[model samples]
Target chain A: MSAEEWEKVLWKTQSYPDNHIPARYFLASLRKNPNFRPYTYWPLVLASCAITQHLATIYIFLAVFVRLKECSLDPRILVWITVACFIGGYLAWELLNCSRSDTARRNANGTKTLKSSILVFLALMALSPVLKTLTAATSSDSIWALSAFLFMLNALLADYSPAKLGGQVRERLTSVLSMNAAISSSVVLGSRLSDGLAVFALILFSVQAFALFPMLRQRLQATLTIFQALLTLLLSLLSICLTASLSATVSCIYAATLVAVTFVAPGILVWAQKYKNEIRGPWDVAVPKVN
Target chain B: MDPLSIAMITDFFHPNVGGVENHIFMLSANLLRKGHKVIVITHSHDPDRVGIRWMLPSLKVYYLPYPTIASSATLPNYFTFLPYFRTIILREHITLIHAHASLSPLGQEGILHAHLMGVRTVFTDHSLFGFEDAASILTNKLLEAALKNVDAVICVSHIGRENTVLRGQLFEKTDEDPSTVAVSGNVFVIPNALVADQFKPSQIPDVSQPSSKPLCVTIVVISRLAYRKGIDLLVAAAPRICSAFPNVKFVIGGTGPKLNELLQMREKHLLQDRIELLGPVRHSDVRDVLVRGSIFLNTSLTESFGIAILEAACAGLYVVSTRVGGVPEILPEDMISFANPEEDDVFRAMSEAITIVSQGKHDPWNAHKRVKGFYDWFQVAERTEKVYESVIKSDQRDLWTRIRRTMELGPFAGLIYVVILIVNCVFFLILEWSIPREDLHFVWMHWNRDYFIELSQKEARKTSFI
Candidate 1:
């Protein structure tokens, strides 16, 4: 038997006391590009549009607040503008729903129905008084801390770019943009009134945006275009600014903060997220498909 | 020797309650009972001795203050932990680094650092990972790199061995040396053992024969309602199973994203009367819950060792578990009914188990005996210690050079052997002919091997005296 045979090195048999070292030691046992899938540039650009719209809306809201603070404008105009925008969004959503009734039907099959959702929303709205009163027992500092914690949680769990129905590009873009707008709407409403109604509205809108919209947005992204998204972003920002300028100094500050937030936050967040997870180790629980 | 200096490294231990954590604690305690110096290294949790903690006599634990990454896994800092690890090893005179949990950074880092420091390393893969998912990919890569110089790799079950071989890519061939990477130690099937005394038939609820009244079969489910746990399967099967076995009741414990889905199932099936959704319970209370139920239901998609099912068997509850991971190997066929990780299969198996129990086809005592035979912490500790000793003995100087030469053929292959080794060695030979040998830095060995040998002999004598 050849003591220096390569097989001896491979099996490391003590029977063969050959000093010959084994080859292929650097071939570390690991999956080569296990879950890697390349991204399409259009999809990436379309996904970025949600952030763009959010920033534009924030800018508009600040501009309105600035006008109100400087020109001593009325808050009624701001409210009217908000209502008008909500109505416009609602109408647009309905139109989209009608156009894609078949797709909506498919999505709704294994999902919650509109009727059940409405009932749940109404129930939550009724319970808002209790939720508002919940913080009454606690101190303001505690509530602040709690809200901040919840916001951080929300940010962490929330899906940034959701998929579309049947991988439609247009539909996916539309849904994501709509979801972001919905989140913006919730933030504004959340900041506006401290009462039960405001709280309920914020909760409702948050669920709609974060939970439901992502699924719809994923469907929409497979269909929508970058141009349409840009147009939507521009128009929404202009409308928000036109209305927001009529509000008070506090509202203006809130508006300005939103603008400041959207512009710088995304860049900062993406940068920070890079170092968020340093998942080293072959020992990690492998994601298996239980067949 | 010298009290058998050992370090048990894991991500989830003590304060973090789960099957893996409980296993670690039990193993540590048993090792300590066997007169070994055991220390647990884990990420620091708030309000729990952040640095060093002593659980029991001769059981010293070091809680490293590291940021938790995801689900208790600490953010992996490879080189940053060198200084602390080095100091700990030196202070404790650690002879073996026995790491637990596949994904735990503490375990991975501990094993890697320990090997570099010339200490024996043994890694116990407590969980099974598939060859899919981004997390698994990264984990596998890191695990591969870390296990490069590992003394031995322990799998909980035979299936786990196959998975380790496949996903870990343990078998390969190369030009410099084409061979199956002979692990210095064996890939032993060390199943997770439970404390049989604590979990016994006496501890469980009285499962006398089917009463005159409706047969009250409480199906116990204590698992995190995650996708991996097959919570969705449980939701799909629970109602149907309950409907089929009218007298049977369900108690689902633990919490996750799938909690809502389970609740919806309960409501949809109108199983509120029969099924109880207990979100989460204290680890101490798990045995109590297991005993209350006549049958234990495990719907986990994958597992290295089904510790819960083993615990249930110890509790004398007829085990009905999904045939995933190392569950099948853990128990004899008579003790438990295995089901595929599907809703239909799980429901069917559960129904069959209920039927059999109602008919009094099997004896719970037999299960208790089998479980006791199969799973005992003392056996695990003894076997583990043997592995440690074997590895320590195998870590000779000759093996190190051979391993390094073998590893060269893996990544930076031909270029290294030809240029670095052959050419350099030739150059050195020629230079020796031209110039005189130069003085080099003389590094002293940290621990005297003779001292450890002497200590081991003394300990053997002490054991004989006892």
Candidate 2:
């Protein structure tokens, strides 16, 4: 007749009606957001920096392509700038690897890096003529459209997480596809250039920006947040500067995207935390604890 | 109270042996015994067993022509079931619709269109689902929509009731406090029951005792070899138990995707001599398998109502089970052993149970008698009849109220269900116009239980006389 008389057990026959809701015990075990941890605005913005960096790389590649097409920059100078970037990036990598305990392994890895870089450099030099004519029969409009589509795929499929295994590259299927897509897009776009040297410079630069830079960025994000923020700022500014004189519309779009990614998206996510509700109770499939 | 015609609708029924299927059959048979007219509606099975059929005790079944998509469940299409449901409800003069299971599309659709025939609706949710996984979230929303205007909701256990209340959104803002929500007054807890006669303890003693082992204890496990059944815990604990107690053996019955793991464990531990695997046990032979052992081990990670556990206890096996949903409420502490769903805890519980069985501290006959007094199918039917009486007396929800309540599903799903509700009404109107009720055939010859008994007796006597 009263709330105290009702028990949660089903064995004993009770005086109350079957549908009678126990005023005190109904849904007493129901829990909301039992394991929820609201994401902070700063950390989310920091995470979004990965995506922003990828977008900036895409815009920078486009700016470089445009400059080469108009003959505003020499292919030899672009090639020299790429070699300087490779050396600077390698020095930064060595500085990061100094914390590792193995000195002998680092010496061996140094030789291996030198050998692979030399091999890739000479290979590009040898294949530039073939790469230049790879898509000669295709229309310039088709090339532009194809490269745009491939770049979008590259940006969407690129791995944005910080390296979990201390900068060792995880060959995820989508990430490999993204690398392939970026390389192929640059190859077709380089076909539009006037000479084999321009195509060689573009191929080398694409390898650095799309392949090597993402690996270094992942390591930087893992090790130093300040470096990641500084790199994101540098890339966004350089991308805007590279596109400003060529097209004002492109520069405005790039600036708006960087602002939205760094500030607006995280703020929206932080505000949306109020709506989080995850129901947990005894009915959930118990995760069995076993050896 | 006058007899009421009830239709038991579900996607799972006879020919598909499962918890839902058996629960429907048993509840329908018990209700028929209580002088209420009962019928079952389900989807057609493969190769055979279609159209109208009769079960024992004159229970009628109508298998609608719809192929099952997965696990004997039909794809949920809101409009396609209305025609068949309308005709059946009209011909059978079903006063109330009792649908079973949350994932059964046939049951949910029956509840959706039951109102068009002016019949009340009752849903019996037999399983528990969490609100986390994508499949659970989708099915919970669908359940919420179907139960928006249901007259009564029944769950099998205390935890199951709470689970279904949240999953089906069976709550309403209180009259005194409009902001705070309270559980709706229609949800009930009617525990599933078994026929104690079927699970009677073994009459003959162990005739073929392995003479090599002086004293041996056979631990029995009868469940689908699946992760949800906590087979990993069994596989992990079985070898340890074999090593710890050289006199102990295992008899595992049933087969599934995880059967290979159990097989590999047996082979790896060199427990091939101690463990016996019987694949795909028939329900009729469950008692035979259970009676061969002294202890029944259940390692289910999640269960709503463990009817199998009760059946084991009735078969006089000392029960050792994971302290999961509703398992604790089935038997008292002294009768059954409990474990956390952990490998070490299960090994500990098994050790205790084996010691108890070896010392003859647990009486199989006493356990059997106690479980018999605990649950019975007739008692479940009597309780379900009370639910039906209350539902019949209660006022049915009107269309406006139903639409208003349904809009609480969500911003998007709410509108979608509202559209389903409106379109269902429009389709009902079309059916009423196209096939007028005056031209349809109404079932005048109802199945009478007394007449059926008399006729069967006569046939039996004639066969014996011949």
* Candidate 1 wrong stretches, greater than 4 Å: A1-170, A174-291, B1-3, B172-185, B202-214, B396-466
Q: Which residue runs of candidate 2 sit more than 4 Å off their true CA positions?
A: A2-4, A165-168, B204-214, B460-466
The residue-by-residue lDDT of candidate 2 on A140-205, one tens digit each, is 999989998999899999999888745466779999999999999999999999999999999999
Write down the worst ten-residue block by lDDT for model 1 chain B: B437-446
Residue-level lDDT of model 2, residues B164-188, one tens digit each, is 9888888889899999988888899
lDDT of 1 by residue, A1-291 (tens): 465433311111233321222334222433455444544444444566554444443344345434443534444555445445444554555455566557657467425554676686678678767665554655556644654454444443444464544335443444445455445444433443445555564445455435454444444444558644655456455645565545556446645644444445545655555444332223334233222
Question: What residue pairs are clashing in model 2?
Answer: none
CA RMSD of each candidate after superposition: 14.7, 2.6
Q: What TM-score do all the candidates reach, one by one?
A: 0.56, 0.96
User: Which lDDT tens digits does candidate 1 get at residues B32-79?
Assistant: 877777777887887665887767544677888877879899877665
